[model samples]
Target: MFIYASPSVERMYGATVDEVVERPIQDSMTPESFQKALQVFAEEMALEQTGAADPMRTRTIELEEYKKDGTAFWVESTLSFVRDARGKAVGVLGVSRDISKRKAAEAEKERLARINRQLQRSDSLARMAAAIAHHFNNQLQVVVGGLELAMNQVPENAKVFATLRKIREASRKASDISRTMLTYLGQISGARCAIDLCGVCKNSLPQLLASAPKTVSFETDFPQEGPVVLADGEMVRNMLANLVINAWEASGEGAGVIRIAVDTVEPAQIDSRHRFPVDWYPDDTRYGCMIVEDHGCGVIEADIEKLFEPFYTTKLMGRGMGLPALLGILRAYGGCITVGTALNQGSVFRVYLPVFQGKPSDTMPHPVSMMQQYPKNIGVLLIDDEDMVRDIAEMMLKRLGYEVIKARGGKEGIELFERHHQSIDVVISDLTMPGMNGWETLAGLRAVDPQVVVILSSGYDEAHVMEAGGPIDPPSAFLGKPYRLQDLSRCMQDVLGRFQKPSECPGDRLQNALQEMPDGAFHKNSAEGT
Candidate 1:
């Protein structure tokens, strides 16, 4: 079928309908009176579809059309598909008209609106920071001055040392305020596993409440059934510490109550939109939610929308990082967070985290020691790039009654191993380093003595690491960073116990190999000539 238009042709393209027969339609939409038409087209196209929509269905779009002289104007387009005798879509037809001046005016207005919002947010931050700085700075000054005075007055032998200790502790806490701000930005990275949430809470509450003003009372509602999250224990502990502590401060002095609820948040209650890019984790096990609530005055209505934006605050002043940091941590784990508050009531911050799927156990799985009793003279070579890690490991191993030798890098480690290949019981090395890595060092050690036992240690994710080529075999052992003192002690003793002087080949095997030599092999290959 064919279609046609008349007056729209002459006004839009400066040509009669005759010119449009073999010409483009974009050139036929420059008419001046189509401003109203553009609005209607925008409304229709706003119903954006996902994936492909059905054919023969109507679709509308907005575009700019050019006249013969290249003078262009905006247009509203209504499009419909043409079909074949077999009922398949063959082509599309469209009708459009001009709206150039309106488009120009709207572009200018949007530019101004965006600038206005940025200015307002910046202005709010400046005002908030000024109001809060004095109180924080004042507290810091007093803690520091008090410590100075105590240092002069308190005698070394006096029992009032306890009070001085408290003052020093308070100063250190004030120091941590800056560090905690970093935690709020989700900059902290560490390992996490399924651990007792209640236990971490109880152990951490004292720190949360310590700096809190006396007027605020803290309480918890943790169920015995256990609320668990798959996360680094210390990192989660730090996250809850920041949120709970912020709630205490928000309560303002001692007049408010902070309540923490730790229970499994039901899957049905969560709006899935909060977790964007939701395609990755289709299972509900991705996160566990924690709610931190306060019974102090609620937040202002106008401020709620911008609450989690970085550096936005309603208080006298703050790093404005608390909520933003919590959101960051959740996002890293493919999770979400939000806040709810009403003026004169209180605010509740909800945190959702991915679940940890670890070995099913009530208590942490403790690696059983392979060596129970042994003489203490065995020595081990410890190789790592970090001086602190190497020093501490060497000291710990030495204290466990074994002599410890230290190497700073892969080259040095190999040198020491080759020098004392027979004496060194086992080699411990960091996997990622300059010059060469753990795998290379292991190969160097094996070249000197194939029986050399090597263990790899690092902060890297175990699953993502590649052995590449070293030792010509899988690692004898691997330990993640921040491993326990006991675990290190046991690992050394166990690995050392497994090491033995290379034994002579079994008599039978040696004899069989000798018999299989070329001359003897000729005898076997020819049989007994019988």
Candidate 2:
């Protein structure tokens, strides 16, 4: 046996086959994998002794193995037995197959599964986008209106400034999250540019700190420069936000510390295939990294391998969207994220973004949409189950020089609209509620006036609203829940503008039709890509 394996086994184990042959098989296997194989062998032995015709008894446990030089690969395997000699097993025979191809296939299968999971997350985002529209829009209106209202009363030196600062910070968070959600869903496209590595980290700290649980302490260590990466500012922020929030949540309300750092690395050529921590490669470059380390209860050994998988969260409340969404955005930009952890010590998530030549922007676009049109004061009827939201919207619209109407439910909203639909130019309603939700309320409103401008908002859809061939109604406007006032106003203006303008004959529309009509090269790519 040793002579037959002398050359190859020597190459694989950094030892002569003669040396390896004398050692017990246990010495040749990794502790964990060895134990598992031993258990399988025991089961196989039992089945054979019972005269059971089991195919699994013939199965061999192949494993990827590493030599002392650190090069690694797959090996086929089998087992030997011990017994008395009347053809009664005195010893056993061991056989193994070189299974590199099978190992490669397994890895490829894993990669494809990861990608499919990520694609599946597109629906989660669509759900969140549609679901939070109303909530987000109204929240933004409050935040923006609050700041606008406080702008008059707040002074730079006042003692109340500290408290005001919190409100502003929270409002900023509210607006940013709403916009960030949209950005994740690709509802909005972002400017692509190169950005500073540490600068993005520093700016992100403030928000990350704001979101952490009160008990969790945070720290940062970022060098001024090493490498810069081309990335979408909003997308990067979203990824960082999710990671930071995850760390906090894992840290358990307030028992742990989360530390983040930035560094640059260049891995060996062999690491390229596995380089992506998130496995969703952005663009093809290889340059930058953002290291997010959390000292929360570390991930279990079993869960570590599946950490980046979509919908695979260790947290009880985790919908598992955050990390996967983070991965999607990074992948779109030609980057990848990775996770590493030791039990009880916590996890370190490393985000690798290929650095490029261009310079990154210092300031991100403000969460507020920069509308070209100066907004005109228009009457808005606000309907929501929550009071803080209603009061908030009421104060905001009134301050904007528009009369406002408020209602607690869809029914009340319909009543108010019935009494004043002529004067009410816009109806802002939430979709998910106990009764008379936004969709139901809009149906009632449309019955009153098919011409009445309507904005539908919701936090989620019970049905597959975005599925291909899903029924689509021609609502005049849609504002996703959690939209800022700017988004709400944008939808309202868009819908109203569409109603006022002529369609199907505009020069731009005509130009688009001409451009899209029989463009062969562009056509081929779309068909092949999807």
Candidate 3:
């Protein structure tokens, strides 16, 4: 027997009514669809044959159907069992509507949901990283500052001094780890400025290559008129260094080439390859792109998505912060990164930064001479909640020939400053405190005297503090915690020099101060201080 076919059947299956009506239903379906239809039919027949009280009279299912041209599309079909005079199932009638658009929409929605979950996880990890970096940095400040003071007291040539130097060096390595964690958390302390991408790469190549194995070779393609980007120069340098090191390590012990290139590209060109969001591009829509390529044991497809996550690594000695920190830096600068990888072949990483409008300065600032003398008679008001930090900072300031005033907390520091603002030539306040934190203390001091010379100090990175509105008014200078004696000295001198001329101080002032101390002075002070 032949079944009737509607005119709409032609529209659905790209076949005329005559062509569809004469053929069996299975003839028009793919093998998978035909098998599925047979299974459903067999199930209904079995129920009917068993004489079930409530047999399946109608059912709905989704499946793939083919057109006359062999194109496939999804269909949701409702089938009814046609019965004979004895009420036995004989034929089938199905009404189906194309659901391909709906299915595509569902797939897109699922993809978006997955991306959202990934973003949420990244956010959670960032928050945890911030908390850890803040506390660890604070503890490091105490350790490092104390060690610096102790080292100063010991003679440079003494064996004890050598031991202390090693301890100090180890402490600094720990501080670097903290900084890496913070950077991955998008809490960088440095301010963004116009940077020549090529210049940073060229300058950092020596250091990066020094860490690479001798078997590996390096090639660079930096254009003479390289694009300048709006980003922190130090962060960029660190990012490049990490990437180059990662490439070198991945290349294994075999001979391989690592190539670095910097060029200017349009956002459209980048989007065509990477599909980044429009918001990632600046108004000009031009990007300064830096590409690092290596012939190495490349990342596998399965691990590519997890590469930017913190603490995810495959190497034996990998800390896993390198790529994640690179990601953080790009995100902080409103930039994007993409990776092209093939297992056992190689990898190419493209970093895109917003191109700055102005040309970078041609002249580099003069390096500070090591023998430059610091001014004496400068007064410093130090505010910190940590007792160890206060003591160590006080010791360092006194050694530098500066008059030091110490306060336990921000509130007390403000009170002291109000009473002795004239005597306090400069204020060095810690950003984090129990009550009246650094920002609040700065505001209070500013209210008392608009011309107050304040240097904001924080264990947190400058970017993190600034993100929390710590530098709204802009301090005279910023001092990162866990700093060395030389770093602190230079920061203070630079800040003070900007406000007033440095007075001539005796070259032997530090030695004189150390000599004046009585024997076992450190032990005596420790007993009384405790």
Candidate 4:
């Protein structure tokens, strides 16, 4: 069709005005755009014929238009129909400008907002998990401690002894579940030290292989001595175990080979797929990487983002804490994870831990012996908000041959310790209380006597308590809740052994006294001991 074309046609469509006028307008646009233009034109023509509105009224729309060389760009076009002197519709006129930059900016803003929302959700979930685990640990401590005491009182040949043992085992399993919840919240108790990924993975391989079915095998690629990261050794092994186990399960009924690898990876090489903890982003230049890849039925795209969510699993009988806890451990170590998968193809999980550049800390804790005995005249100030916990702990301390002074809260403990600072050799205080908490109590006790032995106890792990941040004065030692009699004994002995002179220590006194007293004297009840 012949029509007058503006000289600006060359600038917009990469064609001269004369050339554009010789061809249909569709040539300057993609087929989809041309079809859209036709629809708008038909609507305007119908309105003009019926006199439903002004014929020259303009309408604006954004569409993709093509240049003569076939490159496409977005344009906002204001279109109107030109009318003749008789008020009849004639030709159409349109003005369009590129809006690509504006579109990109809008998209970027939306993406940032979405990420902020995700971080908020992650924080909320972590808080809820921590609260649940903390309360559960507190109650489990009472049950576990009480069971151990009762079992000790009954003879091994008694009928009730076996039942009590079974109950204690069940309580221990429950304790493990509570620990997993804390791990998912990144509140696990473990020391972080510089460790090589290769050594950890290699050392744990035998156990991992034994746990998997014989049909599933491993293919490992590891560097000999490199790729060290600052993290907890046991937690690292746990993370690797979770990944390997998941890979094995994903391999399905057929025989499969799970590939495990460790090496140094540049930040730029990391694939953007599923990320753990939702809020983490890569910040390190180089990272120690562990890769676990499975060739069996891969994960679908829909389930990828949800893989690290607690209790979210595709399997029918899965508890779903393994991946979430793994993510928690990595998050605490200043690391991140990436996943790549395709349905029916395969899956690759890459764990990236920050490479340690400084000198590694080699200090390790000394194990306390379970047979440690307490002194005759020593006094312990036990502080806790729970009546049952206080009562059970008091009985245990008295049975262990230490005089007990019970305080219902931290404030009471501080006041009592001040009154009996010389008599109270050790202060065992619960970390979480109604007011003045364990940290405040520790500071208070230090004010009275700087050298006083204080053991901060919590249902949460020691690492979590330290991470919460308190006064400059740290406790002499930490004891996690739900501890057995042996755990309590070791904690007390360890702190006393480390801080006190050997002659003044209860353990030292017990060794000398054992020659005179009977074998069961230490295990007697508080009334019997008095």
Which candidate number maximizes TM-score? 4
Residue range 105-219, candidate 3, lDDT tens digits: 9977976786777778877987888778767877888788778878877899999998998999899899988888877766773677777888888888888778778898899
Q: Report each candidate's C-alpha RMSD, comma-separated, in the order given.
A: 19.3, 13.9, 6.2, 5.9
Ranking by TM-score: 4, 3, 2, 1
Model 4 per-residue lDDT at 145:
84
lDDT of each candidate versus the true structure: 0.60, 0.62, 0.77, 0.80
| 367-407 per-residue lDDT for model 1 (tens digits) | 65755766544556778876656655655565466555678
**What lDDT does candidate 3 reach at residue 229?**
82
lDDT: worst 10-residue window of model 3: 521-530
Off by over 4 Å in 2: 1-17, 32-74, 77-85, 117-181, 186-195, 203-219, 225-242, 248-257, 264-279, 282-286, 301-325, 328-334, 353-530
Candidate that beats the other on TM-score, 1 or 4, i.e. the better one: 4
Report how far residue 304 has shifted in candidate 3, in Å: 3.2
All candidates: TM-score: 0.45, 0.52, 0.77, 0.81
Superposition error at 10 for model 1 (Å): 30
TM-score of predicted structure 3? 0.77
Is 3 or 4 the stronger prediction by TM-score?
4
The better candidate by TM-score, 2 or 3, is 3
